[model samples]
Target: MSRAGLAAERTALAWRRTAVASMITGALFLNHAVINGWRPALIAPIGAAVAMAALAGLSYLRNRSLREGRHSRGGWVVATASATVVAVAVLAFVIEFTDPLP
Candidate 1:
């Protein structure tokens, strides 16, 4: 495998890790929501799912780039995915501060 391919694989693995974390967090949030209400669980899953999906998309795009020798798309996709993660984090914070729970 070339350097780009190796890098893409490593990034994909990292994305998987993020997905696992998000999944766990989402589960916890679901439990919290069940104990409380729909507000908490809904927000957490939305944020977590977005982040996981972004990471998945990024990894997929990067891997495709590596396979097709289109290295540039990898960078753009990674950046976009990272940005999405940040946005999700911000949403989580917003939910925490202004919880919709009653």
Candidate 2:
């Protein structure tokens, strides 16, 4: 594969890594929520999945642009994905740190 192809593959792998982590988070959260309550524990994983979907979309766009020989706007995608990841992490923290209902 060419360098651009390699780069696209790397980007895809990175996104896949994030998706796997998100899936793991969702599984853990769902399990805990089933044992605890459905409010905070369940919702955080939903947000993570949403972020993962967005990241996957971004990666797809990057790959498509590269394959089409277009100027892949990968930097913007990376930036947006990174920001979304951070936001989801903060949301997860808020859900985790909050006290359970009485």
Candidate 3:
């Protein structure tokens, strides 16, 4: 396998890690939202988690294609999703800080 071949595995692993982190961050924001009755704030992390799942699914498909000797799409989408996750994490933190549990 060429070095590019490893992109599939590495990107997949990164997406998995992002998905896990997104899930945890979403849960944290969800808890805060529930506590403070800020239902709209729940959307940020939910969107991030959904994005993470989509990225993971895409990575899985890309990896399969690569294993079959097809040219894989580059990592731009994964990088974008990672950025989205970071943005959501920041939003979650804002929500958490602004509305502590009483």
Candidate 4:
């Protein structure tokens, strides 16, 4: 394969890695919610986990696009990913404030 093809392959692999990471993050968030017991405040972590799942879905779509050579700018994917991260951060802050340690 040419250098350009190799580059695209690398990009696709990167996206796959990102999707895996997002799934792992979502699992961790879910685990936290479960461990903390089923309080209403635990909803924040549950929501965060759902957001992470969405992020993973987006990553998968981007990866598929890259693999298929449909190389438009990924501005939407980047923006959405950024928004998801920010939202997750905010949710984490809320969870921390609402769930006081013993």
lDDT, each prediction: 0.61, 0.65, 0.61, 0.89
RMSD of each: 4.2, 3.6, 3.7, 1.6
Clashing pairs in 1: none
Residue range 1-102, candidate 1, lDDT tens digits: 877678766765665665566566556545655666655347665556556655655555555544565545455665776786687677767768866556
Q: In terms of lDDT, which candidate is strongest?
A: 4
List candidate 2 stretches off by more than 4 Å. 39-45, 56-71
How should the candidates be ordered by lDDT, best one leading? Answer: 4, 2, 1, 3
**Runs in model 3 with CA error above 4 Å?**
1-3, 37-71
Which parts of model 1 have CA positions greater than 4 angstroms off?
A: 1-9, 39-54, 57-72, 100-102
Model 3, 3-25: lDDT tens digits are: 88687567656655655665565
- All candidates in order of TM-score, best leading: 4, 2, 3, 1
| Candidate with better TM-score, 2 vs 3 | 2
Q: Candidate 2 residues 1-102, lDDT tens each?
A: 888778766766665666566556555655655666666446666666666566666656665565566654567777886897788778777767784654
Model 4 per-residue lDDT tens digits across residues 1-102: 889889888988998988998899899999998887888987789989999999999999999999999878898888999899888988887777878784
lDDT of 4 at 14: 90
Which candidate model has the greater TM-score, 3 or 4?
4
